[model samples]
Target: MLKEALAFKRPLIFADSFFVNKPERVEMILFLMSLCLLVYNLDQRELRNSLKRAKTGVKSQICKLTDYHTLRFI
Candidate 1:
């Protein structure tokens, strides 16, 4: 999700220096970031699917029961 991509603060910071000094390295940095996000999302999807199949929910930050889990929750 766009929110997940935007929430990646530390990776952006880590890739900042590379963008300014070695432009070519930017591709690799972006690739790695994308890969990490993909993995995170896939895992989240699996968790949500599993929970749904089990017909259960978890408490969110606000203490309300939710079937959909966000990155912040897990």
Candidate 2:
């Protein structure tokens, strides 16, 4: 995901640099739309990974706590 973002960054920066001088309304709007889409997708991907990690961590901790309680009772 980081690699993909890095790959995308170069072209986006180049396009912005190219258009920054002329400052056309339509081009700027399009650029903004594309940037928003890229950011949204990247955010979603990162959120999913974070949630997955949290879930796995919670499961492991729960298992450990359960084992500890069982041992104490025994």
Candidate 3:
């Protein structure tokens, strides 16, 4: 298994064909998510402090909605 191999530095390459529009939707979602997370953490001190203080809270739980979206492909 690649996980157990420890020496798994094998180089791999793809022909850049699948790098087109099909997976762009997923990548776009992640990009937008990243941007939202960036702007959100930037604009709100409360959110930052909440993240700093939380083991469990609704604000922290909000990412789980996006996780469900990401999980849909699997």
Candidate 4:
């Protein structure tokens, strides 16, 4: 549903509540969406590993927050 809209170059404004409530699903969807965008732009790679991780379906179901965050210090 959302993917279809985004695929057609339509504007998308996902509410924070959506991701907040379904962190894992949201991340998985985001990763898949990125793959679609990559294919559309003709820049794709084998992200099978990441895809596998997403299938676990157990993320921030309790707190409605992302389970992890990373920072790069350079």
lDDT tens digits by residue: candidate 4, 1-74: 34643554434544443434577887887898788665743321223334356653223436443423211100
- Against the unseen true structure, what C-alpha lDDT does each candidate score? 0.76, 0.50, 0.43, 0.45
Best model per TM-score? 1
lDDT value for model 3: 0.43
lDDT agreement of model 2 with the native: 0.50
Candidate 2: stretches off by over 4 Å: 1-23, 56-74
Instruction: Mark the 10 consecutive residues where model 2 has the least summed lDDT.
Output: 65-74
TM-score-based ranking: 1, 2, 3, 4
Candidate with more favorable, higher lDDT: 2 or 4: 2
At residue 3, what lDDT does model 4 achieve? Answer: 62
Sort order, lDDT high to low: 1, 2, 4, 3
Model 1 lDDT at residue 18: 42
Candidate 1 Cα misplacement greater than 4 A, ranges: 7-20
Clashing pairs in 1: none
Q: Tens-digit lDDT track for model 2 on 1-74?
A: 54643454654355455434455876877788679767766666565566566654222333552211111122
Higher-scoring candidate on lDDT, 2 or 3? 2
